[model samples]
Target: MARAHFAYFHPFEIRFSEVDMHGHVFNGRYLDFFDTAVTGFLVARGCDEILSVDGAGNGVDMADAAAPVYFVRRAGVEFLAPVRFRQRVEVAVGIARMGRSSLSFALEVHGEGEDAPRACGEIVWVAVDRATGRSAALPASLRDKLAPALLPQDAAPASGGA
Candidate 1:
């Protein structure tokens, strides 16, 4: 609910189509929401600068001479709660760890509830050379933009309880 120093905050609006026959967001559809939010999540931290888009609306890699950056892996996903139709949500993202060619992310989704998370998960991404198709070092520009992901912060303290 509060801004976290180590986390990048991203706000998302729930779409009407995200709902399913049951009148709630469909199980499979959450992935799409998560993904869209993730891109925005990256963009907020200046990651959009590295998507390698063409002069047109596509990933033609005009920035790196046709080299594409891809998500080579995923660590895990922990679902916390279901989101109903049109509920506004905020995605909190932070890097759990970083490696030579990868960065691990921890994501949390917060809704209009009084307490608790709507969803949360961890994702690991590897940098690969589009030409070689092999893992490569993350570029300096991207690394600089994602510098916030490298800071270490403590967890939220426990609240009052019996």
Candidate 2:
């Protein structure tokens, strides 16, 4: 995908701790990179976290909230190339789909100064109630905030109207 299409981009330095015995970034580290990018995205939107909090930066007690937090229902990543320690990567995040109680994200990782992505992935999250740990509907506040990142088709299923 073209860089212009992404609404958010974060640059990350590959830490030595993330390197594996194979001398390349560990496969699992890709998920961590994705998580960091997502958190940055949420913070940029004035939220502490997705599915909970009012973006106040205060650590709210999710267990007592009306709706708690988002739980990752599924995640998958495709490694297109290897990355070595001391290298820097740029992560581009985009909202792929939003539902009543869920949202999907697309992530791409590009080596610094490179034009093509070295890795790509998708994450599906579902909002869960803090108390019962059951799924809950998404609040309008979040939907509105995320609207700018959604493509035309991606926004269709996210309509709150019954």
Q: Give the per-residue lDDT digits (tens) of candidate 1, residues 41-112.
A: 676665654665533436654565444476749744555667788888776667766777897766666774
lDDT of 1 at 53: 53
* Model 1: residues with Cα > 4 Å off, grouped in runs: 1-7, 53-60, 66-68, 113-115, 151-162
Colliding pairs, model 2? none
Models, CA RMSD each: 4.7, 5.9
Off by over 4 Å in 2: 49-56, 62-64, 151-162
lDDT of 2 by residue, 54-82 (tens): 55666665444674478899888888889
- lDDT (0-100) at residue 154 of candidate 1? 51
TM-scores for the candidates: 0.74, 0.83
Candidate 2 TM-score to native: 0.83
Candidate 2 lDDT for residue 5 = 67
Q: Lowest-scoring 10 consecutive residues by lDDT in candidate 2?
A: 153-162
